[model samples]
Target: MSRSTTATVARTQPKRAVLAAMLLLPALAFGLWNRPVDAQEAPVEIPAPATTLNETSASATAVFAGGCFWGVQGVFQHVAGVTKAVSGYAGGAADTATYDQSSNGSTGHAESIQVTYDPSVVSYGDLLQIYFSVAHNPTQLNYQGPDHGTQYRSTIFPLNDEQTGYAKAYIAQLDETGLFDGPIVTTVEPQKTFYAAEQYHQDFLTLNPTYPYIVVNDLPKVAALKQLFPDAYRDEPVLVGTL
Candidate 1:
């Protein structure tokens, strides 16, 4: 009951409170240190493999039947980008479709030229330009000039997806640009079996230069290609045409 005894009791109470606070500090520090880490592990970064562009010599091939294979083949041969041109038959039934059979309009095959060109040199669009301007008449449906039948129809047989997309887009662009007076009847289909014509048909104009057909039909194509694409034509083209 005395003042000194009461003061002593209060000071002892303060020491007890400090000791309790020190005891709780370890639990609080441990809880802060052990806060939950992300349950998921850090994702690993895997390096991606390098992609490559195909650069084969025969990178891209397309078949086109403009009018006459002779003229078509000749025109493409002069083009800078064209690697080789083979007169052939396409869009036909799977059988031995030859010039004789195709011309008769019974084989359902077209008198086409298989053009192997380097995409790095010239684009497919440029090839189409040569096709429409000097290669053959796109306005003509199922026929080119005197030739009348599916054998002379205008078509671009695309070899790959890129070619397919480019073919469609080019046709659509030509249609929109009003390049042709009538509908562009050129068919863009997936490439099918291409049968190279017999050896005799390979370079008919170049061989038979003085032939009447070459003078009238084939020579004009050559001249037009030269005039249209002077850069593509060679001054000393093959002198195989000796009539």
Candidate 2:
């Protein structure tokens, strides 16, 4: 080839390379940007298995903490699809935990519950709706009403990636829309060992209808839930007469 031709070809190579990169850049950016939201999107990480329950399986489990377990558990128990809502502790150390021990906050536990439900009847998202609007106040940073401590803090202990995704999305929606004046501080974390609250605490509302706290603070939530989601509420408790 002539020297002039060789020089022209060499100069053209740089422009060709730039053009190729430009062509590929959008495709690369598209993949990177739309990359499936990893499990949960934010600080919360949900394990993969929890959200995808086997279809052959009849039920799924969800854990949440909203102030005292009594109010949280009672609300879920009445929800039509929820087969069980056992108040307990989660997202803390794996030590053997109990109500008394967790109350101190040394155990790193929160008063929580393991809710077993038929996803066919209610969705994880629906359960969360009740959780946010009626289960407990997400705005309360570290306390719910009179209860004060990390134990009583609002939290979602997602069992799997889907739950994690849903939770983070919901919080993001609530935050973006300005649902709360302050930031939504509800913790979205992985599930941990769940220790059931003492039997007496299981159905505190039923067991102690006259308890001042139940009458004053907890019952209102139950009423609001029934009013809000009438179809989901069941008047009869699973434990029956005594909760």
Candidate 3:
């Protein structure tokens, strides 16, 4: 081939390579996006906690880490009695809580959400029921759907001894019934430091409903919450930063 033709071909090849990479940018941006074993994984309707704080009205906080906080936060936001749900990182140190750092899966931070609710209006037991049933898969060991890693593990970070007791009892209750085909692997972890994720991470599902990952993996979970617990599902989500 002529020298001029060789040079032209090299330049053309690089342009083609650039275009190819750009075409795959969407998938790259979201990271490993895995779908659950069953897209229609229905919520497990476990009995309400037999023991709960008798106080009919009071404010309380609960933190949950299951899969991606975007969907977990989204699910709780639509729950009737939850005042606010903020996506964040939990079970990790405060200094390593940034999203970019946590994404590496070595920061010991699991994507988590802080749910503030009026316990009087919605008991903590009710929240736990919804969490195990509708938020994400408890059988998933260290990941949820297309996402894999310890950062996506199913976990409950109870705030106190009472909350810890309730969580443990409920897991036992669900396990005995064989509610799940697989054993529930959710572990109760003591809260370390809950750090609110970046501004862009909060309220992501609500703002980006049509995004590919949300549509395929998360929207159905919300739909199940509405279908199974109509009384508890609210159409308008309670946003965190907004309140």
Q: Quantify all predictions' global Cα lDDT against the true fold.
A: 0.64, 0.67, 0.79
lDDT of 2 by residue, 1-243 (tens): 742233223222333343334446767534543444221111121122224323334798889998878778878877888888886778676564765466666667888978888888877777877887777878787687656777778889988886778788777777776545467789897756676765556666666654444554567677777777778788976552233
Tens digit per residue, CA lDDT, model 3, 193-225: 788887777787888786555666688889888
Which pairs of residues clash in candidate 2, taking residues 3 or more apart in a chain or in different chains?
Answer: 88-112
lDDT of 1 by residue, 15-123 (tens): 2343334346766434433434221111111111122224355446778888768778877877887777888888787675765556666776888888777878755
Which candidate would rank higher by TM-score, 1 or 3? 3
Q: On TM-score, who's better, 1 or 2? A: 2
lDDT of 2 at 42: 13
Find the 10 residues in a row with the least total lDDT in model 3.
3-12
Candidate 2 deviant stretches above 4 angstroms: 1-57, 240-243
Give the true-structure RMSD of model 1: 37.3
In angstroms, give how far residue 35 of model 1 lies from its true place: 96
lDDT of 1 at 37: 23
- Once fitted onto the true fold, the runs of candidate 3 whose alpha carbons sit more than 4 angstroms away are 1-40, 55-57
lDDT for 203 (candidate 2) = 62
